[model samples]
Target: MASVNRFIQFNNETINTKMLHQMEMLAGALADAPYLKVTTRQLIEFRPSESSVSVSVFWRHRPKQIERNGYLSDIYLLGAGYWRHFSIRAWTKFKKASTELPNLKEQLLLCAEEFRLIEKISKERPGTADAFSVRESIYRDYHRDRYKQNKQKGFLADAFLNAAFLQLRGEEVPGSDGFKPLFFLWSGIFDAKSTRDCAIVVENMLPRLEYMLEEDMVHSYYTFGEAVENIPPFRYHEGIESEQRDQEEEIETIEEWFQSWHRETEISEAPAMEFELERGDSSYAEGGREEEGTGEIQQTAKGDSRGDHQEDNDAADRQTEKAAKQASGKFGSANNQVVYTEKRIQVQQDQRGNIEDWRRKQAPYVRALLRELKKRMTQRRQDVRHNLNAGRLSRNLLPLVIEERPKPFYRKTAPSKELDAVFCLLIDGSASMIDKLDETKQAVLLFHDVLRGLNVPHDIVMFYEDAYEASDAAQPNYFEWMHKLEDGNRDHAQEIVSMEAHEDNRDGFAIRWMTDRVNKRTEKHRFMLVFSDGEPSAYNYAENGVIDTANAVSEAKKQGIEVLHLFLSSEPTTEEQAAFYRMMYGNKSVSADSLEHFVEQTLRLLKRTLHLVIQSG
Candidate 1:
């Protein structure tokens, strides 16, 4: 018997990397796509809320933890295979729209979208179909168990979701008396007997599932409003007192008034579902849409098992509308007022002394680097005789070639390469960086000095968000440029040394800001390097900081900019810490254990950067 001894310690636990890698291979095969190109940020672990391993835009990779806890082969592929279809732009739009909907509705729509995408992607990628089938079954079983536990909450939502899931798997669902009456009464249209029927109804309700981001303005209330309008009214006994009947009548009158008040202002028709079965098309449809008005009752039900028709749905609609408005209003102003202003600061006298001292200490390494770079830049020209061939007479040496054998002629041209490059160094100036400020300054000094020696045009910017002053009206994001791209010298060396800790760090915004500057540069090579002691941390950004930063990095890559992260820290001892850094930086991140090792790590990074640039060039 072989021993399962391969392990890596993370957060004080031993994890089996071998097993985790095996799972990755299995996932890649099951996905029928190329291996997801494992990045440090990809963490596979057990989430009780998730039946199988899944990757959400919210997923942060925890490699060590996943290595320790082996996962079921099939369940792990559920998420891995699904994530294969994720695209940055498409995902951002999907996420934003999902946030606008109710929690239950959002989950339902997300599941439907996933099923649709997986089904489509699986057709060309062999094993994906099997994996998708397994995922659907697991999802159905999990939801069924959850519904069983909460049976008293009513199964209308569950049934709607279940039917779609089953239909997605090409299975039929038996008719249910309990949910049939409620669904028909609520929709005033479809009485779904099979899973396919329910799927058609759900797709019609959320037609913007595939193109949510493309919509000009997301009207979240329309779908729920239509659903509410058909909900059967609750009834009272025929022998009820006159006073009670009057009270009910008055409530109904108010409900009618509220609905009418908002109806004219709200969007009435949801954009129709545009189904296309082509593989590369911008559609999520795997099949044709049901004909309009088919199986629809068209008449609203007046009574149901809950007794007299009640105006409860009206209240629900009102609440949904209010919540949507509040959410929209909060970000509207902030989005409108996104302003970026840059300022230059002179190096302080005290900081100049420190900069001079560091410059002297780094003189030898700087000289060596400068000499190598200059040597590479210099080109020597060689002359060669032309118009001569081994089998023919040479024009210039025709007499010698005629007497002996002919020599081939060659031509030489001096090809000089100027290192056309632009560099943007983004420094994290958050409160958490207070302890690491001195080390950060030293590293920035080294970076500035090295580039200065090579005459490379670069910018150094420190970014932070003022949390206390942040609001819907204005978000106070600061970018203090120690060295502008055009600064071009060690003149602002003091400013680099003067960098201090600020409030909070919004990494994604900062990266994007720097990326824009680099994008405008004419340099053939561009690099945006981030220096941060921790993951993105800011007011209201804790939950999404990692994902947002990852997306920002991805965006930069798409624009032909090389984005890298220098994870500045004393030491990262936990898997969570490692995962967080990887999540933000992907594989293009480096770490320094302490201030003492900063120089060594920086040197290694510089060497690697130069090699990549030269190789690619």
Candidate 2:
């Protein structure tokens, strides 16, 4: 087997390469890295580039004992236009990976002793078959907003990070087979290393950059098959339907009405499915008008217990159900078997025409949809109690009366029920972390598991508003739905992320979309969570809206909804950081000394904010 070697090379024109300082930093800082990958490996390569003088950036973040936290592949895709030179720094592992020259081995030990910490010293980063996956979430100094900073700065950081990330990998991310690189780029910024000056700036900085910086911050979410344009288009002085938009999608500019018709269809390689056939367990609460007056409705199995869960059989059942209902309506037949109901006709007219055809076309999608609907119903139940206490809802709901038989009438006093806590997950479909959707998915999985474990009632609603690729939404019984989609395969979600959840997605739009509907919807013990990098633009960012969000919190507080906010920073360059604190928490939020200790930083913040809200409730 070939020895897994490492090395570094510099282009011929290496000038002010910060080489010595870089090597110095890598050596001493190995143990203090952001990730553990760096601390274990060394470097090897061909002739060292005088232009790009290098010292292996190695690290050793071995825990006293190595234990694995669930492994999920994270990929970062750079948005367009944004770019910078040497501004992006490396975590110790990347620094070591960059300097892979075998000849420099002896020199490395001698040249940088300050960096030579507890890890003795090694001639080469030794490994035979595999050291680390090529497509790991190589840590670059992430000081951007979603990770660390705010919108504008985050965009700048994203451009610089993308350039740096691509340069390190030395190529485009792989797709068909192995792994891919996920750049933590963004919406407002879009230019990477695009110009001659851009490359000159970068080339002038690094002695041995492996991947070439292609361009600067041009909005990647918009270009699709073309060049990434500038973000907001509003700021670029262009509307969503500017001249550059494909004429067909030009009609998508209408903010409130972008069609996600292909939402399920686009989730996979398969075609569309009939809604009824796919509506596995009609879990929607059979209450109110939607489910009224059916003489003791019999329950169908949420799913068949038999292991051979055939998509075809599910399809047949749906068809048979509809037909039987339709025939009963038209021919006054018995309530059994297929004959074509109003629902059946509609299902047949859909892309799947025949119930069987639809199932064949979209088996997995149908199941996922059914799962999402069930979650929504579960969440709504939690709100009923909270709304009544707040006086926003009719507290005098006369007891569940069996028509006039129970004869239950509204009493003089208000009645209340123990409202279930409604969990509303506002999924950020922004383009910042496009490739590393596994992180997002992992986040959803983690939060859902934690809540469900506690038997907390909640709902998952996906949000995205990227005009170019369009947008989509969903609410699902997360545990079952995510597991089904993953098929227990957790690694590749980053690669298959939906296009709509890219750089162009807007947070303001997502928040408003959820809130507009939420205003009318009822959920007591309500909690609405916003998960995003906080990159909403001037047009999208509404003070009134944030005020509206605050009011929602106030309303939730009144109803004891227990509103909470969890801001996940993707970069470290927040403008004031306090701004998010003041807005999300009451003003005066930035007591956070530094978030370098990410786990502590976020966890503490979430606990503090949540505690405050609960106390307010």
Candidate 3:
């Protein structure tokens, strides 16, 4: 017996470009509002690899809707009110919200509930429907200017939810009785599955939440930026008791002990040769037998011999002595003591053959490495000496004060300064880079090589989704990703290069995490590089898609951290791939067709931008 209103089918379309624009509006509104808590910057780029985009979309958000419901919806990270269900008094608040909503959904829901109640009561009264109809007509008088106030207060409570009411005349929906259906309309379309999923969350709550819009505060912001300050030193004199005086003195003593701790003279790990070991002649490795000779002298002359420094030189020295003995004081025989020794001949012949093979196969690579090493030797020496001088390690007192030689003991490698800088890598883990995983990984590896060659202090990272999912291991690459703290070196990227893939999409978390990490680290030269295919959707965020991930790139740029953007998709358009423009904003974005190309381009860009020396190789 519920009083039925006219019905209108719900505009059950998915999110598309218009929806993304609406998100941008919402993000901008929240970012400017200062009352809503938001962590986002601005729109930077967009993507559908193989399809280029000219712009990016961004957002800011709060929990404004529910998650799972009925057979109509699917779960997603970025959507309206996903976390609101986890709050305290959700049922009470939501129900209360139904009475004072600012938009169509709430109004429709509130009307239906009231209609059902009055209709039932009308069954006992002869003219109940007529009486309630008159009351319903004036319901607006009881709820006037409410939704208007929300819009004035900064929430998009009206336009975003255009409403339509319909009353079905025939046999109605199973549990719906004769009540009308309230349809919520939006101007965009998204994927079908996602649209269906979003619908489920709206079905049951729309009727009840209409009234709560007036009570809830959704849009707000907080302050964040670096600013150092001065403040009084903390003192806890009031908490001290009379008996603790001695303990305070003990603490001072400990502090003094720490102050006097040794700063210089740790240990060095570079291997060095202190003394020479004897080497042997080629014949020493072979048997002492020889070829045709008029005498033992001729026989010995035909055999091989090697240098005195050679291992097993003992055999040659011994053989010389034996020959001298046979000559009986012929050590320097003026007679025919032909010095054509067996050992010398053999060594010459073998050395010539070995030289030919090495020259043909291994010389090029060896020479390249040697030249590079020699070019850097001076820099390496200065680096070691300068770093050691600046570090907490004290000067080498042993070289002057301790005249006596110290006993040898086992030593282990000290903590490496080579691992000194903190790195933040932001990767665009979107759909466009799906098949280009190998190339992206190669770019990462090439970066590793460049750093080692220049002795540049650095680390690696990638941005995927809005949040960061680090490499699974201590080291990460395109195939595998890890956020675990690790030192950078020639082999530092091996583990990551062996990884599988970054996830399928973006949520903006990774960029935020990268910014925060760079902000927190002390290294001014720290690097943050982003590799992506460029399609960044504002969906999949923690609080609907309230924060803009792209402009967050701009925010990071302002912080002075070095950011590199590398795009690995041939998809004509990719997300934010302008390197020079990125540099102007404080990041480097590279757009390339393949991984190999990315690697080459990154190397060239890094050397030019960082002013790092390129070794011979």
Candidate 4:
């Protein structure tokens, strides 16, 4: 099936994942919380206990500049304002006290406390004024619009809340005369330096406003504290008591320490097993000890069969130990403790027939692409030098001879220089690719056929992890080689067709693994193309996978390997998805909307890359 590429326009502002990552980092730095993770959620929240912050996705419909400013302001508000200055314990108590109040007054109390925290932080950090200014403007406009709508809809409580927000921001309220006493009471919140003060002001104003406002507000403009209701009042005391118990348990007497050390020494010195050496026919003894003078054990007689057999076993044991150590060497980020194995596909005869059938079906498209690539390569390889003084003689020089300037010799350099490059194709074999597997195989087949046609030494491997069996101690990833560089130009179409969808994809680990292999190649140009349907998903890897993959891509580039990503999807690629892929692969990513588009993109990428290689050569 052919894939169609469609262009669509979206009205809402989309968040760029790369930019979001940067913002998260910035938030972490500003908040002095290095591990803080910022994400987009339905509501804006600040969870200091969890070291995370969430900005609302509701800002997506805002203008691009406003959305960016709003996000930045929210980060500053929660990170710098709330994290450092807001008193969680005090806010928790105030929230508990307000449990019986109407939602409008409760929301107003939270909003007032937030404004006080913002004011405190802004005063301390003068540079945050611009972002706060944008924030203030956005809220003022929002509340003003909502106030008129609420009044028209006969929601007096909501309208009063909105009007109170406008009044606090120093904006004129439509019915300020009627709420003069409430406004006078709300003015005390501006002078509040603490959450308790803000809570008190809301408490005082509620007595007068509660009677006029019959219903609670429909929307919650702010959340003062998240998940604080379940906290025990004596939690701090309990923590101290636990620490005291731990300290008491850690103390030991000198005799006890000595006993522990003695036990460790006894364990280290358990016992040793010795093997007796065999002797020849004329040997004095088979198990000779070391002599006192020479301090050397007697050597076994030459050609002792048992000695040779023992030596062979010892050598095999050493080799096995060395192989095990090498296999255990780690890859990817330090947190990713994964070990991978490489295996050659064991293709069956029936699979070979399927491979041939698939190849036959894709031959026309392959031939067309092959012809185009060959033509481009031929054009690139043509070395033409004009107006040279030496080399091939030109007839135009005869005309210049009359003027005594005969320098029109042209040179045509040899066009047989082969491309000095190598390539690797990494296919994601996760179960999510089941629907796209057929097209993925076609693309791989195209990649294999084209590279083989060019006589380019390349490798094609499908990588996946055993999600069910993965763990922190040892995650087993497998690389099933369809074609390997060591195999030269051997036909592996059958092996390529044997690829099956597996459990999960750990893209960063796979990329780093392949980068290590390709980096060792002697080729002047090394290119690695990765095909995956979505972000990395593996045991304990979802959160850090995207960043780790991006770092892996960067590391490959630093090692002179160009990593390009092809995002395979069964539907049209969304702007958000494209941005996410771009975050990992930078501009080297291409999101294909269909199977045909996948093949087309793969060919286009190869052609473009090869053209550059040819030109560079």
Among these predictions, the greatest lDDT belongs to 4
- Residue 149 in model 2: lDDT: 38
- Estimate every model's Cα lDDT from 0 to 1: 0.52, 0.30, 0.35, 0.70
Tell me the spans in candidate 1 whose CA falls farther than 4 Å from its real position.
1-132, 143-337, 379-418, 573-576, 614-617
Question: What local lDDT score does residue 397 receive in model 2, on the 0 to 100 scale?
Answer: 53
- Model 1, 257-286: lDDT tens digits are 223323321221111211123232222432
Evaluate model 2: give its TM-score: 0.27
**What lDDT tens digits, residue by residue, belong to model 2 across residues 407-487?**
223222222322234455665555554543444544554444434433445545554333343222211100001112111
- Per-candidate clashes come to 11, 87, 89, 0
Candidate 3 residue-wise lDDT, 159-185, digit = tens: 122121122112222222212333222
By lDDT, rank the candidates, best first. 4, 1, 3, 2
Where does model 4 exceed 4 Å of error? Answer: 1-14, 48-51, 102-106, 120-127, 151-157, 176-179, 203-216, 228-243, 246-349, 357-422, 430-432, 449-459, 463-492, 502-524, 532-561, 567-601
363 Cα displacement, candidate 2 (Å): 31
Off by over 4 Å in 2: 1-419, 469-500, 506-509, 512-524, 538-560, 573-575, 584-617
Estimated TM-score for each candidate: 0.52, 0.27, 0.33, 0.64
* Candidate 4 RMSD to the correct structure: 12.3
TM-score of 4: 0.64
Candidate 4 clashing pairs?
A: none
